[model samples]
Target: MANSNLPNRIIKETQRLLSEPAPGISASPSEVNMRYFNVMILGPTQSPYEGGVFKLELFLSEEYPMIAPKVRFLTKIYHPNIDKLGRICLDILKDKWSPALTIRTVLLSIQALLSAPNPDDPLSENIAKHWKSNEAEALETAKEWTRLYASGA
Candidate 1:
């Protein structure tokens, strides 16, 4: 889509995202659709996902800002907060979402989630049980999944 056709807010945000990208994160709008973005986020250091690169897709609907952008992981991950289908269990992505939040904030929140997985509020029941019962083992499994699927190799 042409820049002129998009909302001013989208244009400004897209430019800002390109010019001043967040650390360990990259988001670029698709040539075919300005509302669609291809994103990459490096796993935070000291997290089970460390040393891995995760891919994701983010789409801004016609009701963007008023409605939260749809986001999902393209890379396979093992986390209690992320389901097998890559649907995330983040509050900000759901009921806690607000128009005040930006794409940068949402991505940052996801990175923080990776750093602190909340098994108590999980999207994957089995994984949550594993996390609650044996955190060390769950962390190892997460690390192994990251290595196998998100290594960027």
Candidate 2:
């Protein structure tokens, strides 16, 4: 059976995200499917990803709030913690998730991840190696990728 509380919770959260929006992020639930959302995150200032607007998809399951939402990038990003398929290796999205966390908090965490990548625990080994071995070049490549793929904003 569908969780009766899930839809109402999702609607409240979506409304909050719209009203008091974060500085560089915006998301809206799909009209056809309230469980799916189209998300856009602007690259944090002073980060290599700055000037880019990345797209992502977030889906809430019936177990949401109790279980973490599923999220993935739709835009290509050159980051050590995000795989080519756009899967992110963030703790909150995995082992650290809590029912108290909201979509706003998760998106904020993602923005923080773009600002500070952890190459030691990486999703993209090649990008991690590049980040550790030649950070300057890696940053440049990241900027180039942002310009090519996510420069809409």
Tens digit of per-residue lDDT, candidate 1, span 1-153: 587778888998899899999999999999999999999999999999999999999999999999888999999999999998889999998999999999888888998999999999999999999999999999999999999999998
> Which pairs, if any, clash in model 2?
none
lDDT of 2 by residue, 24-127 (tens): 99998887777888999999999999999999999998899999999999999999999999999999999999999999999999999999999999999999
**Which regions of candidate 2 fall more than 4 Å away from where they truly are?**
1-6
How high is the lDDT of residue 81 in model 2? 98
Model 2 lDDT, residue 101, Cα: 98
> What residue pairs clash in candidate 1, if any at all?
none
How displaced is residue 96 in candidate 2, in Å?
0.3
> Weakest 10 consecutive residues, lDDT, candidate 2?
1-10
The C-alpha lDDT values of all candidates are: 0.93, 0.93
Give the 10-residue window scoring lowest on summed lDDT in candidate 1.
1-10
